[model samples]
Target: MTVRGAGIFGLACAHACATRGARVRVIDRAGIAAGASGGVVGALAPHTPDAWNAKTAFQLVALLEAEAYWAGVDARSGISSGYARLGRLQPVADDRALSLARAREASAAGLWQGRAEWRVVRAKAGWGPVSPTGWLIHDTLSARIAPRAACHSLAGAIRDLGGEIVIGEGAEAGAVIDATGHDGLAALAADTGRPAGTGVKGQAAVFGLDRRDAPQVFADGVHIVPHADGTVAVGSTSETEFADPTATDALLDDVIARAVAYCPELAGAPVLARWAGVRPRARSRAPMLGPWPGRPGRYIANGGFKIGLAMAPACAGLLADLVLEGRDAIPEAFRVEASL
Candidate 1:
């Protein structure tokens, strides 16, 4: 099978195909980890458990399976994906949010299937977000990973499974998949004569910190994730219109400031690097998958948006099942027609 694009979605699909005993070739023009899949802030967080639907349930399943999936990849490739399930913290700003957090604790207990817990707790000093209500919503399901490193590890694992990765150019072989990120969406827009999806540019930064064990923070509309490599990743600025997609500007600076303000431990944190990339976002605001309509032997796997890493495992499995096993388990919301 041939998979185009080497970002998280493409690589994960290739890996899944290879694991199913198919010889696969992954082709990419910009190469692996060069897109939003190479981002710094790799927070594998969840939507509010208060809401339950096909989209939220799909994400929950993927987030729950991420640890073992990444561990298997790491074991096979002999490269660490830098995955850690350290959980997450979100501050309660007011009494209204506090009430909602408490209610969700019960909802999570049922939704999470007793595998995890969501509870209201006091903010941990020096490492937690500032809580105006002196309380935070802590969920044990959230985790963090190094995005670039994860991609490298996944690529290595694919090779170990006898999959070939072709950079620059390659011929299509067997069943074909269009897993290209933002560019694929643009191509679909042109091919279908309609808006398929869009490229949403995001900016993120890594700062020197060693709180690898601390829960990630989501406060003031910013994500602060700590990795195992003694670095904290903070992001991002979502821009739909940009003249320079790869350039980092003052918008990222404001994100950093907010991160430090919410989590005081990062007050003096030195900015190690600023990074930017364009992410594919479908109109449905969900991961797009399944066969391309009117195009036999071709499939679509774009629109991961910000949760590509978290969604990669389940999405890949469903895609492989559809492509190889003749199973059609993909959610209707994730189908190509949902966005097209």
Candidate 2:
């Protein structure tokens, strides 16, 4: 089936579909990664302990699937977007939050069991040094991706596989997979009557820090991810239902301050760029991935929100499985019928 809206998810879906022996045509309103997927950093952190059941499961499956997908990309395409498995560090500022973090870690042990990539690290014991107040939850499953490079590489892979990509606003396709993040969903809803998904605006910045100064990935309240270009990405601000895609002064200032606080080397680092984009946030944090409820031959694959980058491969794989191979189960948490 031909796929429309060749953003990360769309491109991924097209790739998976073609690999499964389907003729795929990917269409996009703008060039690839022209939306939220173009952001500087794509942190692949799974949900913290506070995440609900469905969201957490969705994140876990996505992380696992992405690891394999990225490894394949690294071998085949040799496009490395600074992908790394550096674990996440959550710092605590208050006593209450500390207690909550500990409890969440305990609870996650059961939920994350059999998932060998995640573990709880005691202070000063495992992996890296832990924070004094907060417990270090080490998730080897987590990864980082250069958003733009991953998108470009995925699109290139799809083309190399003999799939066609048409760049324009209105293009024809056998089936339209609306993976255009937040900005492209409204028009998709208008074209097909699926409820318009909401948007969550996020702001981020890139700093040209010395590579020797920072780890591949680190996170406290904010995340700092190292890129291949001797730079690190720091972000991000979350706003519900916001429209503006330009990074605000307050947000940029806050990210910079946080980056400097996390790693002093960034104190005088030169700012490379600042950007903001809206992720498609569904009513449920889980992605909407299935044939549009009422629209024939049209599918919805947006609403991945903050975790879009982490979840893209798994989500696309499941969608392809359903669309091309007639599979019924699609990562229990991300199944569209569950939300419906």
TM-score of each: 0.99, 0.85
Q: lDDT per residue, candidate 1, 126-218, as tens digits? A: 789999999999999999889999999999999999999999999998899899998999988898898998999999999998888888999
Clashing pairs in 1: none
Query: Which residue pairs in model 2 clash with each other?
Result: none
How many clashes would you count in candidate 2?
Answer: 0
Write down the TM-score for model 2.
0.85
Predictions in order: lDDT = 0.92, 0.70
TM-score for candidate 1, please give it: 0.99
Candidate 2 Cα outliers beyond 4 Å, as residue runs = 49-52, 94-109, 114-137, 169-171, 188-195, 211-220, 241-243, 331-340
Judged by TM-score, which candidate is best?
1
Model 2: ten consecutive residues of lowest lDDT:
121-130
